[model samples]
Target chain A: MTKTSAGKPFPWHILFFLGPGLLIYFSVSVYPLLDTLRLSFFHESSDGSLAFAGLANFTKLLFDVVWSEPFWNATWNNLVFFFIHMLVQNPIGLLLAVLLSSPKLRLSGTYRTLIFMPTMLSVVIIGFVWQLLLSPLWGITENFMWNLGLEDYFDAWLGKESSALVTLAFISVWQFVGIPMMLIYAALLSIPDELSDASVVDGANPWQAFFYIKLPLILPTIGMVSILTFVANFNAFELVYTIKGALAGPNYSTDIMGTLFYRTFFGFQLQEGSLTMGAAVATLMFLVILLGVALYLFFFQRRIKRFQL
Target chain B: MKNTQMQKATKTIATLAAGFALASTSFSAFSADKLVIESWRAEDTKIWSDIIIPAFNKSNPDIEVVFAPVPTSSYDSALNAKLKAGTAGDLITCRPFDVSLSLYNKGNLTSLNDLPGLASFSDVARSAWITDDGKNTFCLPMASVIHGYIYNKEIFKELKLEVPKTESDFFKVLATIKSESRYTPLVMGTADQWEAATMGYQNFGPNYWKGEQGRKNVISGQEKLSDSQYVKTFEHLAKWAPYMGRSYQSQKYSDSQNLFTLGRGAIYPAGSWEINGFNAQADFEFGAFYPPVPEGQDTCYISDHTDIAMGLNANSKNKKSAKVFLNWMASSEFAELYSNQLPGFFSLSKHAIDLKDPVAQEFLSWRGQCKQTIRNSYQILSRGEPNLENVLWNTSVGVLNGTMTPKEAADKTQASLVNWYKPQQ
Candidate 1:
């Protein structure tokens, strides 16, 4: 083996295969991330040019009243946003996946597609659709509530300060639940059918088989989906932007990290955007995402066994 | 076969790469007179290309001008990057006040004080593009959108209401409409927030604060936002809460526009820009009224806010042709055409334009009648954190939504201002 290794040249084919993709990734993704991290350490000086100001940008972002208030608000909002997704989106996705993977389910393909249709649609279109349906002036939602004899309970959910963020979170979940559903469904399908059959033959019911066998098998996938949802929720910007605008108004009730980062990066209305401040926000977002991912990979992944099915 | 396929794939990619490299080398060869104007009015792309550019070509046939507009939302940052890269256009469309001022301060814009026909604009018309000391004007003022209430003539006629002349009468009309009519009394929303501040607060607040004097006083720290006039303005906004249709807290700007144009609304607190769209959409006749003055106040003020202008890019190579185009923009012929083409956007040039659109003419007539003021939070007040304009948008929405009192709204805005603004500090 040593003689063969010494005789053979290095694997040129592997380099040839990986070179383009790696080069593209480095240029587009990796470089921008590093550059943004570098930018967080610099600031706009008096002459309107970038100057190195080591940690001043991060310090100002975390401690300055004007900056810190919004930063903390957005960070807190983003946590709530993720929690809502983990609580609502994942459970629903898992339930849907389980039901679809059940025996004798008719039109399962159609059901899957119908449930996943919103995920395939543009967020701008969905936001517009939801905004119209919920608008107080539009009255379609109100009229529906009135017809259902729930008119007294009806309120403009999107417009109310108390409900706006929750409403937006639900909208995002509605649009993206299919992703987790699809992942979980594939995991469910990949589990060996004979294992469930063997359990059933031993007088175990379908529910018992699912709980003991199928559930354990899909735990790793569930963990992966949770991490993905966490990252996506923290990075979410478009739906909020489409509906609430950069201000995320009704007194910024729905101002998430994404919108905050955007506003800091690209000044909205009268607020002049600061590149350094934006980079600092981005760096914080990166750290939060990284911490979440690290916790999941180190703790959750290790704890959850990937059963060889 | 697989090995041969790989070889073919590599060759194809190499060929494509070479093609792309060649294609990206130069955008196009252009003549010396080819001048590009960078603007944020992407919505006006058609108007610029079809109407404005064509007209300019008729006068100066040798010059080629392109109306290159990015989306309005990203204009400032895009302009900053382009200017830094030394790749911006010959002409730049100036946003009102601080945005353009900063651009000029950064040496991205050149002073157009010597541009011919600039002398024709009144001080108020030139106010938005001029520097604070009132010595240098970097841009030739293009258009100003005046604020007022665009009311349904049919609703007024049906409700037996005359055009309101004072604050009491305005409320009285709203009450009459609320009691007798199915039509919404005030068609504006807090959801988008800007409408409440722009069409509601700025429309009505100017008279309370006494226009330019009050705006200037607030800026120089002679007056505070929490002062009586400003609180009184918020109080007036608080009063508007009831008159606004049900669920206005959730109503968006587009929703209000749609509601009004659908004839479900009696009044739309408006900027002149809405005139063109309203005219297109509303089947019924509509007329505009300036914000009714408070009972004791005598002198009326209107937010004839200068909204758009054109400036010379500092690094532009073809200065002569660009200035000629700008000169034309400030001319009587251009003013008439511009005012006629876009009815609500009244030209700022001094030439008395024979406006073709009667509604626009009605709005234009207010220039002679009322003292002009821009939005209060613009100019220098919004340069810092907790931007005063955005603050007003929030506070104004809060007041209208009944979540914040007049005093709270005023204090909130004032606190944000004092936190950073040195003058206010």
Candidate 2:
């Protein structure tokens, strides 16, 4: 290591600190991902052997009606799921974060903790609890609807094909909206008070100061929220599995890639699970995620300048 | 940057060394005297721990028996990972297909011909348990579980309806239940693909279509699913669809069961295994009957030779004790205890015990009167085409949802099965 200007040896201690974590990150996350990608190119033999099957899985997924239809359905549903999160969750989170971050706000910590409580619980518990709450026979949802004077509109939304995906998406959004709220709240907190005061001194109202001064600075955080939402939505499994189950029912209207991968990989009822097909599905998911991340990194992320307060 | 790269290299090497050390140590540790058995059944765990282990420990006290209980939902993936790692317990309980052809081809299971108590099982159970070749006998036929529709006798009586012994009579009662009784006429949930099979296809569909010889005929090219009877089953299913629960295609299994158990629905078609659940609940009482056959069909109820069976591990170190356990499983003693525990569910063993549930007793009395027992079509098709069961179930859901016509559904399933079986040919 080179000597510093002070005649001390260069600070190599940071490397020693980061080395273990970096190794673990690569081995546990990065390596398995690459390995799964590699395995997708191969098919298993009749005698428990494997052979290189380049482009076969992809081609089959596209051309073969049997595979293509279900795969596309899952992919489309996953997109719908992600879109719902973006539309419903992010805006709501932003509003909550903004309201809670108000300087004059009272009991902010308690509100923050309580609002985030659902996110702290496991996805499995949330699923079953919601299932019971929504069951028509149970009448909890119906009771709530009656209270709202909208009892007629309260069908078992979880059971209808047209509504199941949206219902589940909203449930998921309800659970995770806290993450975005907290993140944006922290970003808002970091913004110097001087900047807002200056904007107010220039004859700006509270709303104008927020829209003109604070909003542009927090674009990076909102972008981050969007990217995180995208990832979580695409990778979602437990909620759907716990509630709708592996079949993703109501004619598979709620089926996403996660449930599809599970059903294909494990083989249900009579369909024998095929490992090669499962690997192929995984590879597809990896590609979709990688592509999404790449687009964000190259386009949206680079466009958003992180303003220093 | 240079210092960081050097440090990263060292860390990687250290991790590799540590992993290697752990692997070698665990390798030796695993070779020691221990046998692990994994099963999805929680009830079985208690039996193994309380009853069977003591009997096993009596003979082989040195070898420890470890139990791994897996949840039913995730058992497939959990078992697969364990199997791939070659650490899936010394023995694992499996459904028929998993234990039979799947494990056989994977070479993960061993034949159990040398084990004791191979001769005592009923021939039907024996034939269903073993591979077609005599070389592999992975499981001992444990018990048989019958499945069909369960209706509320009290409700039927209140409606002034006799047990619907024919198709038209069944529909008339369902319409009455829907219109007059302020309850769902039928509780059918196809959300889980298996649920629909339990209701329409597995027991009722095949028998109505091709009767007892359907599988053999389909195998020999003597029958096709597009035949008239197959269409009739779909037509009848469609006719009754309106009376089924709202959005029956999307209803989860438990939700549908809840609806029926809570008295929201008048009829529930489910597996006979649920008799235990109904029996346990004091607030409700229900009776089961096969779905009524079409006119002149002569009342054939769907049946299967294989029920829940247990087999000894071929790799088990304590072979003698494992046999004793299996022998105990097949014995009248085991059947008696199990029947006492779950009143309505049937066992292969000839030991007749008094059933606790009156509804179950009544159902059993009608078994001979109907004189029809149709084997589960999916179970039969599972022998040759691995994908057949899923295709059939998925297609049945589609048909029930009006997504696919009965003929189209049948064709799709047939084509898929043909493709799947092509490799075997």
Candidate 3:
């Protein structure tokens, strides 16, 4: 009656609140991403001049023997690294989460805190710590294994080309398994007790109840965890860098996209930095990540729907 | 009463304004003379801050020196970022060889060819810091690092062995040590990729590659790394691998040094920079020797490349003060102080202080006796390629692991070089 419903002006206060955040987001994240994408098209001349080279950098990265060899090796290694996490890390995490979520489990709070402690620490620090523990020179692990009468099983896992990447992946997984554990734990806790009771009352055993009632509910979280693992694994650098160095040594067996990106971008030893090529690598990494996320959303994520509990 | 209050307030305000104006003027005048140097060696922070700057101030009291120490791992990238952003220090510690050349070509460095200090350095010392054209001196050559093996004197004495001068003799010594089983024959921390290349191949590469002449040949496309000489270097490295102890690949750079200092190993291949650390840490006496050459070669070629060189930032507002610092750095007094502070860094200054440490003195004796002091292969290799250090080191790793033959390793390295150089041709 007083025209109050039709007369309210646009919320300038909301714009004011969002403006600074949007500006920061654009500058810090979006702008740099776009700029990197743009830089991938150019090449740095010997005299330090930048000239447009279009897709030449990309082409060279994929086709040229020198660049392509390392590129493919890193790509394949990165995928292997991601798969290791998927196969080993996630299952261990899910088990720990399930066990911790049990009603009969004592000291669950302390266990959760203790288990998550590694994730709280820096990855570089963890990598170094593991390196020392596993070092053949110091014989710390060897001594422990000797005490256990398993000395013959001890090997320089970090040194072997076949074992280095997997060993590093395990180290990474050990440090980060806590993340998925907490995530899955939260998802499990959100499941109502009544649902479990309902399944049990219907003559389902504990295992059957868990399988039919709880597993279906936690599927969505597992999907999310999978996506997160994919992203983190592909983007990882520090662990390999700290343990294996820039060359990702033992003949570059442990090299991942992040280290390759770093080597190309900053140069190592005798190689000069090539900004354009580095940008191209970074752009590819971005596209790979995007493709992964899109596939998750359209395929796996869509199939796993969240149900109200 | 209001008028009197107003007068009093205005007087107080004027006094405060005058005080602030004077304070700011003096501050600007003081800050204007300050010079900042960005150095990669964090270990030198104390020497620079506590002694060097104070000593420099004695000569030029008006100028202040600020030491900005960056860790070696990220120094080049950090410096590059600073230079690109126009925020680089007045004086910059240039990384040796290609990194310095790259910076100079980018016009980030100022030429110091006209500096009077340039004349004092010997031709060999001056050559380490000059441009490819040999006309422009982009940085002031400070000290040259000698690369060789640092051996436990006690172990050598106890084992009844002398410093081996020939390759066969070296192998025989290693064999004796291995047979004794009391210590590792050679302590190599190949887990760190640079160590294998730095202490192993690069140190020995010159002996076979033929020093400056080999460099010229490679650069001129007349020779490749796969050539018999370089291939033999890898083969020799492979032969030496068994003596490096089981799980040598898990040994870090520090681990090798630790093993050497603790008398766990007979020989540790390292550079001159290890002298101070070894002296401080080792309970046993240690001596340095060049890596052995072939059976007939009389002299072992040591890597005598410039260790740390100082360059003036082209965009620096305090270039005059920076040049003063560089001039002081090039002086005999400065060299004496530097050598005394960090022994074993052989100063390029004409009046370098005689190193008093027995180990350093031993290294100096080699420098005097050696027929040729060649640049390390890492220093001489082309920067246009994938790092030769990485290629050589990776290939060396393959040899060590028995995954690839020495010939294959050499061929792979040559292929990398050809891949890089062929495009340019």
Question: In model 2, what are the clashing residue pairs, if there are any?
Answer: B142-B309, B300-B372, B301-B372, B301-B374, B302-B374, B303-B374, B303-B375
Q: Write the per-residue lDDT of candidate 2 for residues A1-309, one digit (tens) a residue.
A: 335666876678988999899999999998988887877788876445789999898898777877888899999999999999999999999999999999799999999998899999999888888877887755488888899999889876887678889999999999999999999999999999999999999999989998999999899999999999888888898899888778787667899999989877776544566678888998898889989999999999998877766
Which candidate, 1 or 2, has the higher TM-score? 1
Candidate 3 chain B lDDT trough over 10 residues, lowest sum: B371-380
Q: For residues B1-425, what per-residue lDDT tens digits would candidate 3 score against the true structure? A: 99999999999999999999999999867778788898888877888899988998999999989999887766776777788788888898876777888788889899998788887788777776678888888989888778888998888999899898889999999999999867999988678767777777778778898776776687777887788998898898889788988888788788888888888999988888889888778998888788788988865677776778899999888888888878888888898888877877888888947677877777778777664555544455656466666787788778877778989988888877766676324
After superposition on all C-alphas, the RMSD of every candidate to the true structure, in Å, is: 3.1, 5.3, 4.2
Instruction: Kindly list the per-residue Cα lDDT of model 1 for residues B310-401, writing each as its tens digit.
Output: 99999898889899998899888889888888899988888988888778888888989999888888888998888888889999999998
Q: Count the backbone clashes (under 3 Å) in each candidate.
A: 0, 7, 0
The DockQ-derived docking category for candidate 1 is medium
The alpha-carbon deviation from the true structure for residue A147 of candidate 2, after best TM-score superposition, in angstroms, is 2.6
DockQ for each of the predicted structures, in order? 0.65, 0.28, 0.53
True contacts kept of 2: 0.33
Query: Which of candidates 2 and 3 reaches a greater TM-score?
Result: 3
**Ranking under DockQ, best-scoring first?**
1, 3, 2
**For model 1, how does the per-residue alpha-carbon lDDT over A1-309 read when each residue is reduced to its tens digit?**
998999999999999999999999999999999999999999885346898999998888889888899888888888888999999999999999999988789999999999999999999999999998887776588899899999999898888899999999999989999999999999999988899989999999878988988899998899989999999999999999899988887888899999999888877877777788889899999999999999888988888766666
lDDT of 2 at A238: 88
Could you tell me the lDDT of residue A3 within candidate 1? Answer: 89
lDDT of 1 at B236: 94
